[model samples]
Target: SSPPSYQNGLWGHVGKTKTPEDVDALVGPRPGLKGEGHLFDRLSKNRDAVVVLDEIEKAHPAMINEFLLGVLGNGQMQNKKTGETIDIGKSIFILTSNCFQTMITHRYRQEKDDVAALESLHSSLANTIRTWVHSGVSASGKGE
Candidate 1:
């Protein structure tokens, strides 16, 4: 099997799980955000996934934090939008960010209360990519 695809906009619409009755539905997934779905979650769900978020920090800080915690591991997201709450169930999450150092610093700075350790790990991986880029080993290292 190849993959599935959703033809909506960048961030697809929230399903009918949040029906305007549940208080938690109003809260959404990303804490205080309105629409409750992560772009990474959406992309990961696609069949032929090639997701790329350039400056990930520019997105809702809280959303990013929530995503780093909830979805990135096994690509699971709980959407509290439908007044009831729904889960993406399965996703193929891929993320990119420029705030590599910042995330790491924040995680190390608050190891006790940091819920985004995986975010820190992702940032560290980004740093590794940067190192590869700087050392000219990322793309050109393929024997050129």
Candidate 2:
């Protein structure tokens, strides 16, 4: 695996998180004398970053509504302590949730039905990837 493109872009796993506030507090700007004093603020250093909110679904819906909708949609996040606007225009945010990925074989009781669902999802994903790859090839003529 190659290194991350940005300085603090690629975070493999953040363990079991419980909230989006937890997400930002862990990665966003902070208060104190100097301001913008957080791990991400220092690590990203005004560069484009990728923040991965692991186990995102574990967070309360209100936090998701407030946090993700606020920062990601607007490319800004405010420091919770001082309400200072933090710029994330060049940042890339990605989230992952194992609790959300319900394996078909695990979701259902009937073995055959589980297999069917697995096949269906796999087929759908394959088709979507194929179409996306084809479109990229058409556009760039590099994936042929």
* Top lDDT model: 2
Q: Give one digit per residue, the lDDT tens place, for model 1 in 62-136.
A: 333344344454444455444333343443344444435665676667784665776667676767765643444
Error of 2 at 64 (Å): 0.8
lDDT of 2 by residue, 1-144 (tens): 212334556553334334444444445423443433243444346546666655544444433555556666788766665766667888777766553245544544445556777677768756754564334323422222
Task: State how far residue 121 of model 1 sits from its true place (Å).
Answer: 17
Taken over the whole model, the C-alpha lDDT of each candidate is 0.41, 0.51
Instruction: Supply the global lDDT for candidate 2.
Output: 0.51
Lowest lDDT block of 10, candidate 1: 9-18
lDDT of 2 at 144: 20
